[model samples]
Target: MLPILDWGCAMYAAVDCLSETATVLLFDPNAMTDDGAAAWFVDAGSLAEWLETWLAGTGWYREDADEYEDVAEPTPWETAASRIAE
Candidate 1:
């Protein structure tokens, strides 16, 4: 995966080189385990979408953004990550 954006605290928005259609959002590694665990989530469907969300000022990362409440949380991408890593 190639990281395109960093949200501090070890979080990032990355492009999956394998699928290329999906964007991976990573949380702080502190929540990760030692047993091949991950803090990755399948967030935006594409970089364009993520950028759109940012431009609209409704990013889920925002403290005051309504998207945080209205939008469903990104799903875990551990399976996809493992598959892609291979």
Candidate 2:
């Protein structure tokens, strides 16, 4: 993952470099799961989409709430990271 933007509040915008389209993933470090692990959400398919939401006041950052809770996962990324390390 290549982080491209620092969208504060413990969130960051990164690009999945391993993906074919370099899909963007929004990382929310504080949004833990049942086991208390951080997860990533794909709210924006691209930089443009992410910017649109931010500008339009419809992003997860807005209202200080996770609006796309049902739109994401965890732990899968950890597996992928281990695989890549090998």
Candidate 3:
């Protein structure tokens, strides 16, 4: 899988995954506030629509993206690290 290195973009994708009932790990060197997360969630619908439009414009979907797969839950230390990184 292609690794996501952008913190803000990763956070957005993580939320998107959560909204769709999937799991994701969000980590950022720079901290994000609760308000920031809330604001993103507030605009998630519009953001998702725009993302889909942009991806479609770039023919990204034609690349045959795989379906979401279930992954093992993170360990306590991993969860703590993810939270700290965020």
Best by TM-score: 1
lDDT of 1 by residue, 8-86 (tens): 8777777776675666565556657664346667777777787788788676677776635676467777575566456
Deviation from native of the Cα of residue 40 in model 2, angstroms: 0.3
Q: Candidate 3: minimum summed lDDT over ten consecutive residues — where?
A: 70-79
The C-alpha lDDT values of all candidates are 0.69, 0.61, 0.33
Q: Tens-digit lDDT track for model 2 on 8-85?
A: 887777887776656677677686665433466665666666666667776555564565664223223444334335
Candidate 1 clash pair list:
none
Over the full model, what C-alpha lDDT does candidate 3 score relative to the true structure? Answer: 0.33
Name the lDDT of candidate 1. 0.69
The TM-score values for the models, in the order shown, are: 0.74, 0.51, 0.21
Counted clashes in each candidate structure: 0, 0, 0
After TM-score superposition, what is the CA distance of residue 60 in candidate 1 from its true location, in Å?
1.0
Taking all chains together, the TM-score of candidate 3 against the true structure is 0.21
Please report how far candidate 3 places residue 44 from its true position, in Å: 3.4
Candidate 1 lDDT score at position 82: 61
Ranking by lDDT: 1, 2, 3
Q: How far off is residue 61 in model 1, in Å?
A: 0.8
